[model samples]
Target: MRLIIAGLFALAVMLSPAAYAVQPDEIMADPVKEARARDLSRELRCMVCQNQSIDDSEAPLARDLRLLVRERIAAGDSDSQVIDFLVARYGEFVLLKPRFERQTWLLWLLTPLALAGGGLALWMHGRRRPKSAPGEDGSEAILSAAEEARLQRLMAAEPPPESPS
Candidate 1:
């Protein structure tokens, strides 16, 4: 009885993920239609699950997305048309692969531009720095001999160091 119960528990755990909403029977029988549906599902958002793909999401919204995709495929809508319809209805946020033109051009280019800008800024800043030296003398190389003599006199006039004893 204990072993049977344990086996049943394991089986339920294994099958639980399949129960998340979409059933295999919902997919079209034609292989070409099925492939298109799969591709669209991967691109469409699970409106309920938000971050999950329609194909993998168990949300009611994901199921609706799946059904909508199949219906569009059946209605002779081409892939781009169906995607356009969804984008029109749901905004570009629904697309897993956002288009690169116009408003979204920044999304594709901003990071590299920022990195290159930052690299150039860093390179310029580094170029302005004097090469590493043993002491602070290198930083003060512009000072005249008179300035150094005055600074040395100031240092020499300081009180004697106190003993720690």
Candidate 2:
């Protein structure tokens, strides 16, 4: 049915990868340079949309960044040079994935360090736990003499329940 076809089309659009936000006017005439610009845009963050790559962000700042990338590429700057220029201009926050450096060592190492610390603490906790000896019912808890006597007395004092007539 037409309804089902329309629904399928809608679902396909929704499931597809996000469309790039670059406008027609922003595209460079040279395909090679444009492609390079696009690749660089995808690596740079949209300052306005902090989590989104400039290539995928529709923000005015993202558009400017895309244009800047194209301008840099046209000026014969290499990818790394363009990236370094942007970093110098906007700080490291402009990069979608920051490079590992002495300044960023803590940011890059914190997660693995925390995970290792947690694993070590869990291992120590497991080792420190007293192990129960296996018995007929799986684990035997050894009761003290007074506790055993108390249990015996309590069991002996409990009356047997009468069976239902």
Candidate 3:
């Protein structure tokens, strides 16, 4: 009976809606404003949980940010205006997806630049490698004629191994 109750409890927990950091009091009365606030919250980064958005973080800073967004919406601030305010107050680090601007140009451009540089390096490496010579049997020869001759001479000079008793 205990095992069955435990199994049912586990199943109930699994079926429950995903928990969010937003508390009931933080939600705005107006549906449209609430939606806008939620959207903005998802875009804003949690200062305490650097990788998580304020909407998904339970930290005190995240809660404060969530309330600030709702407060801005209630005061009739446009979405862009709220974002600009946050950016001004906390800098670009407050945004989960940073704006493409002069200061962040290198952050946005580095990946493509690195990929292009790597491709150029690979192409140059391939060009510098010697082309293989085709053998009489239509197979590529891995060793030069001088190296092959030296290998043959070395093999001839080595004694034959005795058969196992």
Candidate 4:
């Protein structure tokens, strides 16, 4: 149906990953510089929109960051230089991907450390609990001497079970 086709088209548009928040006035005149600026925008996190990059955020802070990146690029700063400037202005938290320096080594190493800890815990748990033997019931009837004597007396008091052959 036409309605079904329209709905599918709308859903497809929504599901696509091509969303960008860059405005027309923000684009640089030079193509190469614009490309570099765009790439830098992708690398920088928008402070106002915590999880989104400046290139994909509509926040006023994101717009200012985009302009700032373009200005730095125009001023003949290299990608690394621009990034360093941003880092110096705002702490290392501004970068979407953090450098693996001494200060950030713990952040990089934590996942593997946690995984190893989990694996060790699983191994220790496995060692502590032995597997039950196949075809063997673990439960056993444990009776004390008094209990055994009482059981014997009760058995003697009961009539023999009639067997049907």
Candidate 5:
């Protein structure tokens, strides 16, 4: 009985994905167009899925995008031209590998600039931090033996209860 229940559970789980499945409307009129549609759909990101390509996604927008690709292919648009058209309609964010250009130059440069800026900030912070030893201005750390003991005790203090949980 347990084995039968387990088999039924596995089948249910496998078939659960068929609930919001792709429909017939997503197909192209011609098989040749359908092949192109499938290829293009794999390249095109699904706006709704945000990560999965249109071909892998079962979303309505993905289906529409698939149909749009089929229509474009049937109209005899070259692959590059079709991609360019979509890029023009949607921003470079749609393409998995965005074309590097004047418009997207800032996007390409921003991460490196941010990293350099952060490194600069960290360098500046380290420079500005008060030196602990008698190195920066030759002022020796004059923590008395008692004060050092007290500081050590404070540092070794146990953590309090984490009330947020």
Candidate 6:
């Protein structure tokens, strides 16, 4: 059926690896430099697209970033130097994976800290909960001895039910 074929095509597109955005004109004559450029491009974020790397985005800003990386490579800048230049220009946000330093310590540790807090809360909640009696199916009201006595008194005050002959 047409629907089945369309679904299969959609699935194939989704399962495919990320597409490369580097055009033919952007490739360098030297394979080594080109490889380095590609590696750096993969590490750089596409400012316009926000989610994809420069190497995998089709946005104009991503294209510019790709070209800039190639230019730095051609100019004999070391990988570290190129990365430093980008960091200086775009701040640390340009890096896909930020360094674990004092400035970013909260970002790195927030999840674990929250998870530990949640676990402690759950444990404390369980500890403080009232224990249900055996065979109590959780639907009946749980009452203390004094409250049960009061309920019995109230029931005795009511008239007895009349039975049909």
Which residue runs of candidate 4 sit more than 4 Å off their true CA positions? 1-20, 134-165
Q: Scored by CA lDDT, what does every candidate get?
A: 0.85, 0.90, 0.90, 0.90, 0.76, 0.89
Give a tens-digit lDDT track for model 3, residues 5-92: 9999988865643255888888788998988998999999999999999998889999999999988888989999999999999999
lDDT (tens digit, per residue) of candidate 4 on 63-119: 899999999999999999999999999889999999999999999999999999999
Quote model 5's TM-score.
0.52
Q: Which stretches of candidate 6 lie over 4 Å from their true place?
A: 1-20, 134-165
Native-referenced Cα lDDT, model 2: 0.90
Per-candidate TM-score against the hidden true structure? 0.68, 0.75, 0.74, 0.70, 0.52, 0.68
- Candidate 5 residue pairs in clash (backbone atoms < 3 Å): none
Residue range with the least summed lDDT across 10 consecutive positions in model 3: 13-22
Question: What value does the lDDT take at residue 12 in candidate 4?
Answer: 85
lDDT of 1 by residue, 79-98 (tens): 99999999999998898778
Query: In candidate 1, which residue pairs clash?
Result: none
Q: What is the Cα root-mean-square deviation between model 4 and the actual structure?
A: 6.2
Candidate 6: 10-residue stretch with minimal lDDT: 12-21
Report the C-alpha lDDT of model 5 over 3-72, residue by residue, as the tens digit: 9999999889667633333456767668877777677766788788788777777788877776777778
Compare candidates 1 and 3 on lDDT and give the better one: 3
Model 5 segments more than 4 A misplaced: 1-36, 49-51, 90-93, 130-165
TM-score of 3: 0.74
Candidate 4, clashing residue pairs? none
Clashes of each: 0, 0, 0, 0, 0, 0
Model 6 global lDDT (CA atoms, 0 to 1): 0.89
